[model samples]
Target: MRPVPAKAVTTSARKLADALRSGAQVVVLEVGREAGEGPEPRNSYLAGHLPGARFVSFEEDLVGPRTGSSGNSPLPRASGLQDRLRRWGVDDDSTVVVHTRQNPAVATRAWWTLRWAGVEDVRYLHGGLSGWRRIGGALDTDVPPPGAGSATVRPGSLPLLTAEEAGRLAASGHLIDARAAQAYRGDPDRTGTGHIPGAHSIPGADNFTGGELRDAAALTALYAAHLDGDEVGAYCGGGVSATTTVLALASLGVEAALYPGSWSAWITDPTRPIATGARPCGRTAAERPSAG
Candidate 1:
């Protein structure tokens, strides 16, 4: 692999297309939430996607138990992700490139999870599927048979912080709240979510200017404004969007721990404090989850 401008963050559509044509062990994955009114993403992929690309399940592949105390999309068990990767044709040496539709936030989840699972190289297509189309990269409607990958896998490649550990980091280090600015400020109408105490509001969407990720220098400078020598960490409504924060930091040669249980899990326990308003501060009282 030639040197990327930064770490495992960005990949060009041309490089990916060339890699596919060269028969490199490259697997492209289309990853994200289901769009408002299309066939399911798998069906969407069947309709059109990069050649040999597969659809990744947001619920089954990357996230774990939905009912657990751990938030909406908690991190999946290591074994679950390993199996998913294998079926996608990922091996120890396979280069996995992931892309998303509207935002790279979800795809960053795949990128972060693949790297955490110890894949040698993982990347996010810079402009996502739209980028591929913009570059005139061809798409195929044919779905390949399932791949047989026997790659050994493990977790812990990337640092993960539990809800408890994240609280500690927020108090002592940099903990970024990656959600809409309104939600970060605890807009009750949006949902019953709020920032953890001592967190800085930096929506993952803000990580990108226009529709693509910000350049590494800009990213580093953006983060540098709020941080000062403390280790960095991030969390969102669930754990998924937070990986974007991790990826953005990784590009700048900074390693950010992820709080997989994020605000979702944090809100589950009434004992856990919740903070609100523009600036984060200690919680006054635990708010109850709104009844449906």
Candidate 2:
């Protein structure tokens, strides 16, 4: 198998189209939230998606069952993910591209999860379906038959953080809280309010401009102070949005660890400290104000 290019974390729609046209062994997975309420949410992929792309459910394929106390979107069991990857036709050498029509966070979650499951050469679709449409990429409603894949899954390809590790990183290194500024500041009405003590608030949405990832120079500026060649980690409500921060850092050639059982899991233990306010002392970013 050919080696994946260093830092080939994202791909453009046009590039993907050309690759597909050339008969490159690529697996496109459309990640999206399930619509409607009730026990069974409607699959969003049924509406429309990129041609030859399989639907990866936000509620099902990407995460594990919640154990009440576990974070809402717990990392899916590795064995289960391996099975799904095979069903998606992901071979050891196949390049997997994930995209979403809703929040980019959903797509990032799939990217992060696939990496965690040890699938090399996984890339997120830059600008998502809209970007594909901009290039006149076609969408289809046909669900491709189950793929015949022999890829094996080995978890821990990427860095991960436990609750204790996250706490320690916050004190000694950069532990970015990737929730909204309002949520990070402790909205009383919200369920899981406030952030981990000593964490820096850098909302995941800030990583993008007009729904696409910011340029490398802009991202570097956005995270200049925190990426001082030191340990950096990110976490959000349930580790979903935080992947955006991790993805952004990856774009800069920075490997930031992710806390999968993030704030939701943190709050499960009353002993864990929660900080409320704009920014912790000595950890303020002028570019990130609390008023957002």
Candidate 3:
């Protein structure tokens, strides 16, 4: 019997194909946001996706309903997510692979969410649909029958941070603001203006090149300054893009927490400090004042 993959955070399309051929118990999820207006669910998955791949809505399944105080992308309810996971055929021993068309952030969001939900063997499909096509993997329009999975969702398998904790981490540890540089610098024209005071500006896009994650050495150098921080966390406009940073750090064997509420939630409370301009608060991670 072929051994099932274990502890891998990302899988290439070729490797995934081999695993499937070997009869590994794997569930492939094609996650993305709805497109176009109107009642019909228009998404790339509707056109075509990996054979046996299930569609997971980025807007619906991955996030909870927004409230006045909640961020734009609040974490979904665990029980609700559990039901959806089972419907998607995830089981206790299933090796779940998530992917999207081109946007790596969307796919990584699913990866992070599944990990947070305690799906033990979740992985991001590197290069997404394009990679699959490059490897001559077939796409199927037929939706497979709903799965019968006994997987239980226990949230917080991965580290998470609240607004307060994110703020504190920025001051003492390494808190990364993963929005674009303009947004991080509080461009007047951008939404969610400014960043959490003390957060470092490290756009999530930098982690990828040509729609794929950069090599580990590049990632290491990109994040070299903060790699040794006592603690590390990441946040973005609504908590969507920051997952890419978390994913990149994870690839380098670093466990950086996600600030799910992120900037959207931070700005809701006027009392929370917001910093603007190019400079981030404090210096390098080693220079940060110890939490006493």
Candidate 4:
């Protein structure tokens, strides 16, 4: 099958079914819950999955560690990713669809992680597994072990920024912080309040409500209002939350980028400039003002 352009996230259940009907080898990844939790599929998944869905735990399999060094999600290295993809039977041409438990945030982290490892035909299930269940799709709690097939990544598929690249792009207004208004304003004491020196606030939460994406018209308006379709980058505290915005834009058929390192990386360097109190670059808060 000729590889199509990237898939959108809205109405993703139907889109996933269409992809499956196309007879393309699809790998459905379900981001699992935190530890000590049972191997239960999310409400979305239990109601119904898109068939042949596999499970990957977010905390255990996805995030590596919280060491202050390295990218926030600190990708588990391309070689490890390559091995995982191969085990999952993902070749160069596999169309991997990711679905999480209602929140697009966790799924986006995995999406960005695969992109970092050179997986191009990647997408997230809009509204996540919950959305699928809402639409009366199918589900599978038992995930099969990975199949036997290894895949190699092309060069630059993982075009991620080191702290320096992040700082440079940030200083140039190319990197946008996609956390909530309050977090960007330093209302949350997770870290520094302000954004990266020249970074703009474009919170990821604006993507949806009740596990469904905002309407296309609303998405277009949102993107135009915040991004203006410029060279954009999305990042949250640790790079997980920010992917929600990326997923949102992709679902709207808009091309947005991800910083991956996000605010965590910015604060790593004590010398890096930080901004707080309100939206930088003349943009107003998408929500309540952050308490700087």
Candidate 5:
């Protein structure tokens, strides 16, 4: 009911097909990890994918080049995004549906970026291609010709956090480390892990089970337990999974800032303190991070 209670996610694959059939200026985008878990998911798209769906590279289209202290998937430049949106035929009123084969992070990243770039009707496909195929949707192999869209991007529709603001959030407000529990607790296998001090551990995996996000009531309860702050923010290995947390927060009517650099950037400065174990620092007035 009401699209699963989140403004950002669509729960029914068949309903999405209905929208496509009705001709609602909709566009489907497939995205995946850059290096990928094994073979990249886009390879499947190359073989056959959702009809009219275009592939958006997580590395090329979604993220910027890793500059000083930048993470693996930092936010892409708005001008570059504007050009890409034009190529994809996205406009101010376009309904963008982003999906991924591996996980929801990629889709959520694209959804958040489009919303941040001021697109009003962005949503994440509930179960991805697997769900689409299950609902009698058809796939096509041919790459559709690019549409000539004139959508100009205006940024800052959503809140953003720099490395400095993130540090303050971890200390003074609520900073969530949206990574695996092991990573949050400094897993020995991952080099340079151990979350930012004062941040809370909230794995992105908890938001979804078997590729479907939990219901609104469940999410509200899950988040209310850990969150009761004036401000809230999120970060992850890079910037991808953090969007899931942002989406989760949005479902509960909470707004959270994103730390695009996240852990990868936090570790760049050898001098920064690292916190290990599950407990949060819980400080009220932690000093803000200074720009070097």
Candidate 6:
């Protein structure tokens, strides 16, 4: 559906309210840290949910096995994902709106996943569930069981990147690392540190202001400052966090692609080079930061 224009994309509460008042026939999809006990939804749902929100867990719904850390998400088998969506009552025409816990990175993955599954009209609730509650939105505790009718899903090309792709991005001045600075420099204490070689950091948190997305002008300004005239490709620890950067670029109408495997996949390659310690702007490995 090309996503109803970025401006038309609705917020969490407003979308829910619209669904109820206008009976827009949309499905509210909540992405939480974990799945709740039983099929009756969880804390978010019980604590006043939108009229028809169905909750799903990040671990159970968003990803599958870790594969010994080779791949970041390692998408679940197509048949399994399809069956689960069918159980969730999603169909060909369902306007599936996804909400997560303010982690734009994780939420973007869900958005990308659904889109990759051929589910059009998927949108992310700006600022996620927390923002909805802050705005005093209404909620429901009822857990609607999955409906009948199977969802036939056709998997599309996964937008994941490989080591060679990362290398090309590095050489072409395009790769972007979306991790915090401490982590981006290969901080020893952090589980994963150091960014893709030639990749520059542009933290995803820059996309928001006062807990909501900043205006489009701000977005364009921010990205323009960091991108350095390269086609942007975002990546984080395991591609989960990088999606947030991709979303921000989208908000600015930038043609940025996401490296789904991201750092996790990059590090796993063993053949890829890893840079350590901090470097100043306009500096690469072995280049000392100028004191000027």
Clashes of 5: 0
TM-score, one value per model:
0.90, 0.90, 0.90, 0.78, 0.89, 0.82
Cα lDDT tens digits for candidate 3, 1-292: 1112235688899999998889888899988774552354435676788988998888889999899878999999999999999999999878999988767898899999999998988888878888899999998899888888999999998889988899899888899999999888775333347777788899999998766788899999999999774799999998989999988888877888999988888888877766666888522233333555
Candidate 4 residue 100 Cα shift, in angstroms, is 0.7
lDDT of each: 0.79, 0.84, 0.84, 0.66, 0.80, 0.66
Clashes of each: 0, 0, 0, 9, 0, 4
Q: How does residue 212 of candidate 1 score in lDDT?
A: 68
How do the residues 1-292 of candidate 1 rate in per-residue lDDT, one tens digit apiece? 0112445567888888888888888888888576752756576676788888888877668887777587888768888777888888888987889997766887999898888889868998888888898889888898888898866677888888888888887888788999888888875434445678888888898787644679877886778765456788899988877888888887776778888888888888777777767787634344433556
Model 6, residue 160: displacement in angstroms? 2.7
> Per-residue lDDT of 1-292 in model 6, one digit per residue for the tens?
0112353333556656657688777777877663443364356556666557777777787686777655667666678788878878888777887876546656677877776677766777876777777767766778778865355777763354566776677667567787787677874333334666677777777766644567778877777755455655778777777776766666655556667667777777555666656652233234433445
What TM-score should be assigned to candidate 4?
0.78
What's the CA error at residue 272 for candidate 4, in Å? 1.6
- The deviation in Å at residue 162 for candidate 3 is 1.1
* Model 6 error, position 248 (Å): 1.6
lDDT of 4 by residue, 49-141 (tens): 457876676766666656776556766655666777787778777788887775677787788777667777777777776677666776655
The list of candidate 2 runs beyond 4 A from truth reads: 1-5, 34-44, 187-192, 281-292
Instruction: Write one digit per residue (lDDT tens) for candidate 5, span 143-187.
Output: 878878878798998789998888887778888889998778874
Ten-residue segment with the worst summed lDDT in candidate 6?
1-10
Cα RMSD, each candidate: 4.0, 5.5, 6.4, 5.6, 5.1, 5.0
